[model samples]
Target: MSDRDTTSLLTPELEPQMDSLNPEPAPRPSRPRQMTLNMGPQHPSTHGVLRVVLELDGENIVSARPDIGYLHTGIEKECEVKTWQQVVTLTDRVDYLSNLANNLVYALTVEKLIGDIEIPSKAQWLRVMMCELSRLNSHLVWLGTHAIDIGAMSVFFYCFREREDILRILEMFSGQRMMTSYIRIGGVALEPPRGWREAVGKFLKQFPSKVDEYDELLENNPIWLNRTKGVGFISLEDMLDLGVTGPMLRGAGLKLDVRKTEPYSSYEKFDFDVPVYTDNDVYSRYRVRLDEMRQSTRIIKQALEGMPEGPWQADAPKIVLPEREKMKTQMEALIYHFKIVTEGFRVPAGEAFQAVESPRGEIAYYIVSNGTTRPYRVFMRTPSFGNLQSLGTLLEGRLLADSIAALGSMDFVLGDVDR
Candidate 1:
């Protein structure tokens, strides 16, 4: 046989056998076969401008990637050029759920930087009363809306009904329902209103019973239980890695609370407990926040009962705006008010960090100044950003139904997350 003919015959037969022996390219690992679904800068499940990219295999979410910055307001950057006094106003928008808490943290930071201003005991205690009520207000919004997200309609109305009373009490004191920038650097925005004590006291008396109602409606309800009990469970290891705090951490049984650990705004003086759970699931988180609402009521009652009476704003003319009457009568008071409103107040060049136990978690502000009318820099360590990281981890392997339950447990406010 000719050599060329023999080679051609063997090439077709032997090439097929040789290719089979080379491992078939390992099938390219199948590219992992994930279906990516974008779940909102608009979807209802996200709760805000937060968009989560879900990588799924059928009904199970194999991975959840959180796409943030949709609601970024640049509130932090805007504060840098504003005077220290003006920055307090910016803090109000950071976490609207706990605006007072945000104001309290920022004010404390600026106050610490400018040395002590002799904040009155009355002012300090009033901050306590209002802040706890603020926490209760935040939880009500979270529970009601979260329940609504999960298809429980009753919790929404019930929680909002109580929230309205709290807001009314807030308005009586500061003349604003939600953004009561009442907490100032040296003291409150105003003295406790004439009827605030009675209003708050009545609410306080009944708020605990209302919380019991939330529990009655959802605690053991078969639908709620099925949706939340084991869904969105995040282990301690994952939580630590993700930097999640507040109810999310407590839900995992860590019992780490800034109020208990660091004790700000005279939090140590109050007798309250930080609730914890070992389950680390959606229901555990709901339970922890609900318990926090109860504890907050207790603290508020104590504050109202022992409420002190004194000057509401600080004596410092440089920081706090003088009274309107004094501004007209006294040249110095008038000048100080003009300077504070126009150029903002100056602080001694220094740095300070103040953290508060906000309803969602540890809300902190790291402030720095060059002793000028405006802040050199202002950075917020918001709780929502920390809590958002766990979504991907918690959502992985969860069914689509469980995604919402887990998201609700996070109690994320994109306003805070994006700020």
Candidate 2:
């Protein structure tokens, strides 16, 4: 056939329009669609392994959902298997930056269950000093890392310099820098080192200047201000509803420090301000933490200057380990030491909950003892877990870049959250 005849025979008006065989594609939706982005479980800014799923409309976060549990160490469950005293070490791993705080809270909780045990005045003072130093340490880390995240690299170096001094002091006290676990159940793990007063005095004397240096660097820098001031803000009501605490809550102008309100471990004996701010933003949180470091120094100075003269450990023979000299001299002391070492001290059959103001926020230990050496049940109401609940709230309807600042302001430790 001719080419025209063949083409016409094949065409048939494009095969009867093909409209009956297939309908036209539906019109595209008019509005643009959001896209989901996975931030990370390994993001350096997350402070640990924490993944944030963000639904973004262009560069604005439409919604944010945190995917946690990547760093679940099962430390809480591990606590149940450990002796009451052994668990202090486990607590040290929970919020490592605030290791002393965790150690103190767990120690205090166990002590509460062991009721009527008189922790020494010296020991109490020592605990206050160590914990406040821990607070300083944790806040220093937060400031350094947070500042670095926002492009202030010098602050990280300055903050870590002082932090190194604090870590050395911790090492001197407990022979370990990061996970000291120095606050034992009835008292500190050991007597304060001989030169501890001088060492701590040196750091405290120098620290205020370092904080001022940080302020000089970041407080007025236009880039820092633009990144933090009035950014990542949430109302006090929303914060409270989300269980936000620590600097995040304080930044909202609430005087809700657990140290002030509850006064555990002789916090009432110290005089300091809670450092509240009405702004409720990243800059406010930054200011609050800086002031907290100062207050912690005040508490440390008080603890050092007026340090009580007495035994470092409680007189409770059953709970606290006996002195080595006494163990060598007295048979009864030897027996108690052996017993406490071979088999852990038994806690009275009861439940006790003790809360403390950690660097992150309120970290409470809820413990049940069935009159056994091992805990019946151990649960930690960790601040990071509570504070992380607000991540989604803090990021929603905000710029995608603001998410890191908001996360850093919360200062959450994933180990604390996952436990």
Question: In terms of TM-score, which candidate is strongest?
Answer: 2
Q: Which parts of model 2 have CA positions greater than 4 angstroms off?
A: 1-27
Q: What overall lDDT, based on C-alpha atoms, would model 1 receive against the true structure?
A: 0.87
lDDT of candidate 1 over 90-163, digit per residue (tens): 89888998999899999888889989687888888888888888998999999999999888999999999999
lDDT of 1 at 210: 91
Which lDDT values do the candidates have, in the order given? 0.87, 0.90
Angstrom error of the Cα, residue 311, model 2: value is 0.5
Q: In model 1, which runs have C-alpha deviations exceeding 4 angstroms?
A: 1-33
Angstrom error of the Cα, residue 252, model 1: value is 1.0
The count of residue-pair clashes in candidate 2 stands at 0
